[model samples]
Target: MNDERDRLEDLNIEEAVGRSTPPDLAERILAAAGKRELDDAVTPISGRHAVPRTHRPTGRRMTSPIARKNWQGAGVVTAFALLFVVGLIAFILLNDPSAPTEQDTAETQEKTDQDRNQPRQRFETPTKKREPSSPDSNEEQPTQPAPTDEPEPESEPDKPEDVVDQPEPRAPVEEPQPEPRDTVKEPEPEPEQPKEEPVKPEPEQPKGAVEQPKDDDKTEVKPEPKKVAVAYIPEDAWRKYEFGRYSVRRSASDEWNSIHGLEKEMGRIWLYEGWQLKTGTGELYFSNGALLQLDGEVEFHTHTRGLRIELIDDDLYVDNVASSSTVFVTHEGLEVEVGNGAAVIESSSGKLGIFCVDGQVSAGGKLIAAGHKASLSNRGLSSINEVTRRDWSHPLLTGARLRQLGIEDFDPAPLGGMISGKIETRTAEQLGLDDDGHVAVDNGGSASVAFRFDGDHETLRGEKVRVRYRVKGAKKLILQMFCPARNDNFGTDIVPGKEGEWNVLEIALSDLRNRETHKDAPPPGTVLSSFALALTGQDDAQIEVDWVELVREAEFEK
Candidate 1:
């Protein structure tokens, strides 16, 4: 047995790799390969490499022991392959210190067999129900362990070997023992979801929810009692039945009803047509809040609003013109407007006189100031004289009756003619030019101060309308001419002059633009219904009009 063991030891792994090789072994190997040796081939002896025993030089690796081996064609290659495979397996078994020992493997294998024989208790990896993720969190939400129906994953018992680290550190497969531990976990109950209630449609308002009133149950609105227009005589006022008396009638075709007594009610309770007080004096009141005192022959014709006194020649005093009402006194060619004031208007043979007592008067485009006298004619107004003591005063107009109109505190200081029938009269001072009395207006958000002229605008057709006036807080000043013959409105905006001073703008009538077409206006014929000057801008603006001058200019070339 000892001889056999020695023999086995000798054949264990060929020879030691440190043994030197023979010189002629290379030539023999080359001869077997059927090739000649290289010219530079030199042999190197193994023992004393610094010196050579033979005269010829040897190769650097000629003395190696393994090269001297007498192996044949494929025998050496096969031996090397077997040795490499054996070395790889030995390295795997011995590299890791944590790798199982032979005793440990045997113990574990014995335990595994015992466990299998008793009964395989299949263990399942606990699966979890994933929790709902929060909208703001980036991390995955951990899951809760839940009971599952699937059995244990016993089929992959050797799965840890595959999961272990790669070959260099792979042998300690038992260290990753989570496969069994991950299977054991306490079961967690899932959170119950709240149930949502079903939404029902809302019912509309029931038709019978509110009871309808029957014909008898319905309430009716009582009609408002209308205030009637009235005229009565006051006992304190004096009157005369001398030459003629006051006459009242309904229509123009009806006969005049004479009023001679001191009867309180003279005019009817409604609108009447003819009124002629041609005698000493008369006092009358219309329910429209208009009080009138006529001195001479004064005739109040028919009117829809207030009185239309067509005086051929008479002195008529008016007061307390009700809200939104007018008292038109049309004489020869003179237009005089008085508001809450006394004025004696006289006319004798183409001559007229305006005597203002308490307030200002606008007569023939001239402001007749209080305590001043002005001569009025067909031409215009002139001869202004201040009176120390007023010679003319109203006998019956005591100003006590204005309270019945409810506007006793209201200032109707006449803003001149806003239009034909929309004229409010009162003496107003405007700026420093109040010596001639100016008009300030606040027609309830109407931003205009307009004056209308009934005189001949035909002569001014081809001329420039030069106006001299002082204004405050106004924007554009518009001059308009309404032609009845053409039935068109010709208007032009005057460029503003120096501020805080009187402005004189000479605008040609030919330059008036057609409001609709925004072009030069055509010739406005002789029949112009209204020639007006209006200021537009700044609410409640004031304007003092000195004069509306016309310069006769030759017609422009077409």
Candidate 2:
């Protein structure tokens, strides 16, 4: 058995050697031995090559004895090698202790740098490692600070790869830093909204950009009345009869006449042509504010009394008893009063006249007659000292123009011209007189001319006619006419040309319609019932009247 074991061992050894031997081994052995032994030793096999070994080098060995050994020896060899490597590692560690520590720190810094590079990972790391203890341990490992984290104002910058592990500090600082930059960028984009507000500006049109228009103002206008003209012959003739008011047109001619007595209930009065007064005697009391107007001649006896009388282009014949008669004369708006009817005419603006056929005459106030004296009382032709007055040297009334027309006595005449029968006079009481000698044939030194005409004395009963007259010494004259048929009154006021001038006065017959007398009558009738004239005071106080003419102005429009 032993022998067999030894044999087995030898065989094993040989087998190991055979597996490990190089290709040139046999030749190298022969060269070292310096002999040719191969031919006898075994002309050994079917495969045998013989090579010369003289060129082989010496002392180059490849195989070890232990490597060629069986399993136990191989195990023992491996154990020895392990032990040697351990010893070498122990030597390195013992010599420098900081090396391992430094290595560990360097690994941690690399991880820290990676964490810093990945900001999302840094924010997520704490959630992954939720335990406070684990995070603290991770933090305790010294690491490079993250570059993404905002630097402290006092802190220096850190390197890129060395900034991975400081997750908590870097996360908060970087988060807020980006927010500030985002806030700055956010405001920069929204200021473009103001361009949309300018489209609503249409309110400037009515604020005075356009202008407006204008209109006119003067001139007196008169509205046409229902009845324009009228004519009436008083039914009863007034002799010594007193009247409240009476207006008559000369049913005989185009001339007009009107009379008013202010007494209460004096009854209807009468009128006649030429104002011829016989023994017709009665007093007219005008204590009740009656207005009277005379167109032709108004005769006053000691029996009649009156308050206000206006005359137009006519003579005012007065006796001694008809005193204290206030006569207001008007051409237009001018007015004047003659205190008493003593053969005197008072006008407000223009000429005045008195017809003194029988009674002693006196003149006062501003007299316009060339021969008439100022305040001269021409009593019974007792000529006073001749007061030679110069002719009007004014441009308005040059003597050359005055002489051309042969303007004469600015006085009233009994008749305008030569007539037929001795101007007939009649009274309301049916008293008639033939001659001028019977004018004041009574118990008193008084005379009144009164008469009445036929009702159909003219073709048209009533029609409108204007009266034209020349007023002496009238710088400005106004003539007014009053009609009692309708109780209407109208007048015209004249403007003086210059000083000391005679003015021609024209009056409209339509204006003299009597409103009260014909209240319900139609507008265009031809009755001129009463008339009044007045001369209001002006620069030229002297006045004379002549040649009363009548003209028709207008007919009432339908």
**Quick one: best TM-score, which candidate?**
1
Q: Write the per-residue lDDT of candidate 2 for residues 1-558, one digit (tens) a residue.
A: 999999988876654433222222333343323222211122211112212121223432222232334545765888899999989986897798566676786899899877644422222333445556422222333334458575333322221221121111111111101111111110110111111111111233343333211111001011111110111122233432323233333222333222432111223332211232212122222222111323243332111222223344333322221222333333233333333222223322244433221123344334232223232222211232322323122111121110000111112122222111122222423222221211111111111111111120111112233322223234344444333443554444456334433245543443442334522322333333223333445333433222233322111111
Kindly provide the TM-score of model 2 when superposed on the true structure, using C-alpha atoms.
0.17
Listed in order, each prediction's TM-score against the native is 0.26, 0.17
Model 2 regions lying over 4 Å from their true place:
1-476, 486-488, 496-499, 511-523, 538-540, 553-558
For all candidates in order, the CA lDDT equals 0.44, 0.29
Candidate 1 lDDT, 294-337, residue by residue in tens:
66655554244434565655565555321124455667656566
Instruction: Tell me the spans in candidate 1 whose CA falls farther than 4 Å from its real position.
Output: 1-257, 260-271, 302-306, 321-324, 388-390, 393-558
Cα shift from native, residue 150, model 1 (Å): 99
